[model samples]
Target: MDKKKPKKVFVQGAIPPEKIANSIANHQSKTNIGAHSIFLGQIRADEIDGKIVTAIDYSAYEEMAEKVFHEIRESAFSKFDMTCCHIYHSLGKVKTGEICLFVFTSSAHRKVAIEACNYLVEEIKAKVPVFGKEIFEDRTHQWKVNK
Candidate 1:
């Protein structure tokens, strides 16, 4: 029987840190990885000018988001000497200080893992078709695509 390659991409709704950690551990065990780097993005309650953001409503052009995310994974693999990658972003509502995105990368060495993690996060932020709604303390909301 042929062994399956480690997951090249992971996309989900409201991914938890524990789940992401588990996936990373499982991938590390399957591959002889010497390093794993992770990026965790959290929602912040901040006052943008005069508006205070209270919570976030996350939505995606699901088909387009998936397509873009997969393309990013493939490109990351091609560009970096990494063994595996995972990308997860929240759906529906995510409150302040909760996780919104998690990107994990494992490689045979620390340098590649670190660089790949950074690159993957930047690429995803720039390319994914996910949109976020900033809910203010006054109960008003505004949708903004990540920039």
Candidate 2:
């Protein structure tokens, strides 16, 4: 039996807008898909304790993260009637307003695609072992925690 290989989720830096557009464009050939949902995670310039965040530096245990990502994909496939799914997350530094993560899902209907897209993003955030360092304007940094 043939199986689809797991895709590499980590990118070197910020996910470009063009990449996201290209992904959508590439799916136009699939005639069965009627809906597509996309989620984009962008770094915010947040202020805390008199410091302002300028960027976010991300890192992860690649082996473990890849395994978790695969698991998430499998779970989504089993849970939803999804036609396709794609996830891309950035490593290294992503400046404020830059995209750090992208999740795309397609299905025959709108609800399935939207829910699957949301599920993928939530699972990636809650399950993946990715860490972020919030870099401040003063060149100082602190670890980020998801709320």
Candidate 3:
């Protein structure tokens, strides 16, 4: 993978399982990679104020978000000895139990891969401009705050 090029990090809706599977498959050819770490962020149906969250509608300032994503990727590469890193985030409605974010990192050792993946996830949550609206089952909604 070309680390210098910016990848399209946002997906239109919930990320499909096949895309994740394909990513893993694609990395099989890289014989030097000894460890791979993956993080999947799934939407949860949480009861808040007696209402159940049915989904999260996500949105972002695309241009700015992409810039942040690139910076996160670069930072991860510089901080850890990662062979490759990829991140995908959902942009539209993602239902409870659906995947909203995916982060994959690979390296020659387990520690580096794991640390890079965790770093990417934390940086994204802390720095990205993405917003999420929690949609309740009864049609009510509230803006989500990262915790």
Candidate 4:
């Protein structure tokens, strides 16, 4: 097996929808893969105490976050019998309805790709050192909680 080096996961801001499509297009030449699974995390306009959220400003302990992301990638590679995987996350202000995270996995069949995609999402949520500050419509903000 040809194991590749770890890739940088953080983007300056929100991930673009075109990036997602281009990623899939990039893999079209790899004929050995028959299935691909993707997971996209979008910011939500949540209501709290009558304030409506407008966007989220994400922050991370960059060094630690990158290290953790590498670890998660390694773990997924080891655990899943898959062809490839890619992960990208936002590092700055991402408005509601914008994409923040994107994970893509490919395999010879549907099961491995789907399972690996799910695994990566769960691991990223539980293990990454990323934080989000919810910005409300009136410019008020608060820390976000994953639930």
* Candidate 4 TM-score, C-alpha based: 0.96
Q: What TM-score does each of the candidates earn? A: 0.86, 0.97, 0.97, 0.96
lDDT of 1 by residue, 16-126 (tens): 768876876687456578888989998888888699888788887777777777777888888898887777788887878888888888889999999999998998888
What global local distance difference test value does model 4 have?
Answer: 0.93
Candidate 1: residue 116 lDDT (0-100):
92
lDDT of each: 0.79, 0.94, 0.95, 0.93
lDDT of 3 by residue, 1-147 (tens): 236878899999999999999999999999999999999999999999999999999999999999899988998888899898999999999999999999999999999999899999999999999999999999999999899
Query: How many angstroms is residue 144 displaced in model 1 relative to the true structure, after the best TM-score fit?
Result: 2.9
> Quick one: best lDDT, which candidate?
3
lDDT of 2: 0.94
In Å, residue 71's CA in model 3 sits off its true spot by 0.3
Model 2 C-alpha lDDT per residue in residues 1-147, reported as the tens digit of each score = 115678899999999999999999999999999999999999999998999999999999999998889889989999999999999999999999999999999999999999999999999989999999999999999999886
lDDT of 4 by residue, 1-147 (tens): 335666899998889989999999999999999999999999999899999999999999988998888889889889998898999999999999999999999999999999999999999999898999999999989999987
Scored against the true structure, residue 96 in model 4 reaches a CA lDDT of: 98
The RMSD (Cα, Å) of candidate 4 is: 1.5
Better of 1 and 4 by lDDT: 4
Please report how far candidate 2 places residue 39 from its true position, in Å: 0.4
User: Comparing 1 and 2 by lDDT, which wins?
Assistant: 2
